[model samples]
Target chain A: MEFRGGWDRCCGEARSCRMLNLGHGGVRRLSTVDFPQTTEDLSLLYKYFAANQAALTRNMKKNKQLLEEIHVDLDIQEHLKMQEGARRFQQVGLFCILLFVGSAAFGLYGNGVVSKKHLTKDEINIHFERFFRFQAKMGLQIQATNDRDISISFPIQYLNHFEISSIVPEPTETRVEGSQVKYAFKGRDELTATFYLVPQQIGQIKGSVNVNENTFSISHFIFP
Target chain B: MNPVLRGIAVYLFVYVIFRILGKRSLAEITTFDFVLLLIISETTTNALVGEDFSLTVCFIMVCTLVGVDYIFSVLKTKSIWFQVASEGAPLVLVDDGKPLLKRMQQSKVDEEDVMEAARLTQGLRHMTEIKYAVLERDGSISIIPKEKK
Candidate 1:
C-alpha cells in the first residue's frame, strides 16, 4: 500500500536500515509509492510514532520548568545579599555619629582657655580699651573693683554712648589714692578712658580688673 | 542648693517654659526661639547654680515666664486679632506653582531661603514642580508637589 504522509515515506527504508545499522548513523528513506499492504497497518504504526513524539515534548517542558526554578532561587539570594549590605552600612553610620558627638562633648568640658595670674601695668593699659569695647558689645554691668588705690578713667563721650544705668564705685571714695596725679578726664566720650598705674609686681603677671561697665584683662609683666 | 539639684531645676524650668510656648518641631524653631533659649540659659544658670541659689526666687521667675507664655498661647488660639498680634499665621509663599510676590513682601521671608528649603527637603528641582509653598508657624516652609495631569 502507498502511504500519502511524509512520515510513511521517510520510514519505508527504516526497517532495512534498522537490521543493518540500527546502532550507528543511518538515514531512513521511506517509500511513499509502495508500502504496507493495508491502510490499517500504516495507521497503527503512525500512532505509535506520534505517541513517542508527544512524550518527548512533555519531557522538554519539564526541563524548562526546572531551569526557571533555579534562576528564581538565584534571584532571591541576590536580593537578600543586597539587603544585608544595606543593613551593615546603616549600623556603621550610626556608630560614627555617636563617636563624633562623644568626642565633641569631652573636648568642650576638658579644655580650659583662661588662666589665673596677677595683672601687670603695661598689659592692663593695652587691654583696657578692648575690655571697654567688649562690655559695650555685651551690655553687661561692670561692678566696682575690690581695690581702692587703682584709679579708673575714661572718655566723656563714652558715658553718653552707654546711658550709665548705674555707677557703683568701690570704697565710695571721692578721690582714688596712691597716684600723685589723680587726674580723671573722660576721653572723647565717658565710655573711653586712659588710666595710669604704678608698677607693683614682677614676673609674668595676669589678672582681670573691672572698669566702668566692663572687665579688662592684663597679660605679661615688665620690671623697671 | 546642690549643683545636681540646680541642674534639675534648670532643666525642668526650661522644659515647662518651652512646652507652654508651643509645640514646635526642631526644624521649625525661629530666630526668636534661639534668642529666648540663649537668654533663658544665661538667666537660669545665674539663678539656679550661683552663690545666691534660692528655689523660691527661681520658681517665681519661672512661673512669671510661664504665665507670659500662657497668655500668648491663649490669645493666639482664641481670637484672630490676638493671634495675628502674638503668633502670626502661616504665609502662602507660592500658589499654584507661582511665586506670590505680594505675600513674600508681607511675610518678610527671603525668596532664596524658601526656594532652598523646598529644593533640599522636598526634592523640588524646578519651580513648576511645586504646587504650593506655605511658611509654617515654626519658620519652616511646607511644599506641596504638583500632580501630573
Candidate 2:
C-alpha cells in the first residue's frame, strides 16, 4: 500500500524511519540514504552554487569595470585642470623673468661710469681715519695702501662682522671703471688693498681688485 | 656602558612593559598607567646613562618583555576567547532608544558623557534618535541608528 503525505510530513517521516531502521540490511534497499544518493544531491547543490557564483563573479566584473571607468574620468578631469594651472603658472613665470631681466639691465647701464673729481690723498686719508674709527668701534680693522700712478688709495678693512673683506669703496667712486674706482694703498706690510665703488649715472659696482697687481674688472654693470 | 645603548635598552624595556599592559590599559589610561610610565622612566634613566649598567642585562630584559608582548599579540589575534577576555565585552547602555540607567551606572558612564559622545560621533541631539548605545571594549561608545525602512 502507498502512503500519501504533505512534503513536510513526508520528509519528517523519512528522517524518523531512517533513524529507526539504521542497522537493518533491508533499510538499504528501502532507503535513499546511500553514499551515491548523498553524492548526487550534493552534486546538484554544487551545480546550483557554482552557477550562482559565476553570476556573482560576472556582476562583480561589471561593477569593477564601471568603477575603473569612473576613476579614469576623474583622472582625466584632474589632468586637464592641472594642465590649465601649469599654463597659467608658465605665463606668470615668463612675465616675472622678463621684468627682472629688464630692470636688472637698465640698472647695470645707468650707473656704469663715474665722472666725478678724484679725492686728494690727504682728503682720502682723513676720510679713511674717520671711517676706520667708526668701523673699529664696530669691531673691524682697516689697513691702507697707496698707489701714486693710479691716484688710488685702497683701504682694506677686515669686516670681522660680515663675510666679505676688501679695500674697495663700495657703491660710489669718482673714477668709473665699470661703476668702480681703481684704488689701492700699499705700504711696508704686504696686505693688498681692493677697491669697490658705485658710479652715480651708472649701475652698482660689484667686483674684486688686486691692489698689488693694479688689476681691476667689472663683475656686474647695472644701467639705470 | 655607552649612553646611546643604555637609552635604547631603557626604551625597549618600557615598550615591552607597556605592551604587556595591553590595549585596554591604553584605552582606559588611568592614573595607574601614568604613574607606571613615570616610575619606569625614572628607574631606567640612571641605568641607561650610567657606566656601571650592563648593556647585556638591559637587552636581555628588553628581549624578554618584547617576547611576552609578541606572544600576547599572537594569542589575541588567533583566539577569539582570549581577545574577548583581554579586551572585555561591550556593555549595552541603551536599548530600543531607552537609556539603561543600571548599565550606565555599572559601566561608570553618566548620561551627559553618553550624550556628548553621541553628539560628537553621530550628531545625535536627542536620546530618542538612538536605537542602541553600546559602550565598546575600548571605552568608546558605539551607536546603532534605528531602521527607517
Candidate 3:
C-alpha cells in the first residue's frame, strides 16, 4: 500500500531518512522530533549553536591567515597609499602652479600691462560718491554762476592730520565750529579746492556743504 | 609697483582665498572646479601684471615667491602653531570597531570610506572587523583590523 502525506510527516514515517542534510558532515539526520519540545531539547540546541559559533570563528582565523600568506591586502594597501600620496603631491603641484601664474601676473600687471581707469569730470560728477582712504589728498570742484555770496561747510573731524593747501578763489570769510569749517566765497562760474587730510580713525566719514539754498552731503570710509 | 612687492601681495591673497575655501577642497576635484580655477587665475593674472612684461620684473617676482614659500615651509617645520594652522592634524574616525559619527561628519568622512580603507588594508569584509580607522593628515584613511581570537 502507498501512503501520501506532508513532507515532514512522510519523513517522520521513514525508518532512516536520507533526503536532507541535518547538520555538518551529515552526522545527524532530519527528523520531526529534532524540534525542541522540552527543556532538555532546548539545552541541547543551545549547545549546538555555541559549537557552530566556535567552529565559524576557527574558520575565519584560517581564512585570515591564508589571506596574510598571499599578502594580497598588503599589496592593495601599498597601492592605495601610493595613489593617496600621488593625489597629495598633485595638490601641492597645483598650489605651485597658482603661485607661478600669480607671480608672473604681478610682474606684468604691476609694470603696466594694463592701464589704470581714469574718470572724466562728467563721469565723476555723474557718479559723485564718497571715496575712501587711510590718508589721501581730496579735490573738490564746483560750478556756480548766480551772482551772490555762496558758502561751503564741511566737518573737520574727518581729518586727523589736516591742512588746506590750495583754493581756486580765496574765501571771502571763514568760520570754525567745534568740529566743522565753513568757507564763504563770492558765487562765481567755477570753484576748486585741494585739501590734505588724514582720517582720525577707521570708520565712515560724513561731510556736508551748504551753499545759498542748496545743501549737499558726501560720505567716505577710512581704513583701520 | 615693485615686482617683489606685487608677488608678496598676490601670494598672500591666494593663500587667504584657499584657506577660506577650507582643506577638503584640495582632496576632491570636479570638472567645474577646474574651469572655475582657470577663470580665477586668468582674472587675477591681469590684476597682478597691470602692464609690466620686463625680464627683470619677471625674475624678481619669481625670486620673491620662491623666497616666501621657503620661509613658510621653514616656519611650518619650526613652529607647531603654524603647522597646526596651515596643515590640520590627523583625526580618528573609528575606535574599537565603532565609528565616531561626529568626527567623521566634521571631516567629511563616512562609514563607506572607513570600510573601503579596511578592505584595502586588511581584507576586512565588515566594519565590525575593524579595530581602528584613522583619517591621516594627507586625507587618506588608515585602518587596523580586529585581533583574531
Interface RMSD of each: 29.4, 28.1, 15.4
Q: Count the backbone clashes (under 3 Å) in each candidate.
A: 22, 29, 16
**Superposed model 2: Cα runs more than 4 Å off:** A1-224, B1-52, B147-149
Given candidate 1, what's the lDDT at residue A198? Answer: 27
Angstrom error at residue A37, model 3 = 30
Q: Write the per-residue lDDT of candidate 1 for residues A1-224, one digit (tens) a residue.
A: 34355543232235533443321112222444555445575555455445644665576476531111111101112122222232344356456557746754553211212211233333233322212211122122222332223445333323223333333332223343332112232322123232323223223434444443344654333221
**Please, what are the lDDT tens digits per residue for candidate 3 over residues B34-126?**
998899888877655656777877677778889999999999899866665555555556655557665576566789888877888889998
Estimate the overall C-alpha local distance difference test score of candidate 2: 0.43
TM-score for each candidate, following the candidate numbering: 0.32, 0.30, 0.43
User: Can you write out model 2's per-residue Cα lDDT over A1-224, one digit (the tens) per residue?
Assistant: 12123212112124433443332111212223332235454455345435654665587576532111111101112122222233344456557657756754543222212211122232221111111111111111223344343333222332121233333433223343544444323233223233332222223334333333443332333232
Chain A of candidate 3 gets a TM-score of 0.38
- How would you encode candidate 1's per-residue C-alpha lDDT over B78-108 as one tens digit per residue? 8765553333345556654556554454345
Q: Please, what is the whole-model Cα lDDT of each candidate in the order they appear?
A: 0.44, 0.43, 0.55
Candidate 3's C-alpha runs over 4 A off are A1-126, A131-224, B116-125, B146-149
In candidate 3, residue A101 scores what lDDT? 72
Give the per-residue lDDT digits (tens) of candidate 2, residues B61-135.
566556666776899899866655544455566654557664565456778877877888888888767666777
* Worst-scoring 10-residue span by lDDT in model 3 chain A: A65-74
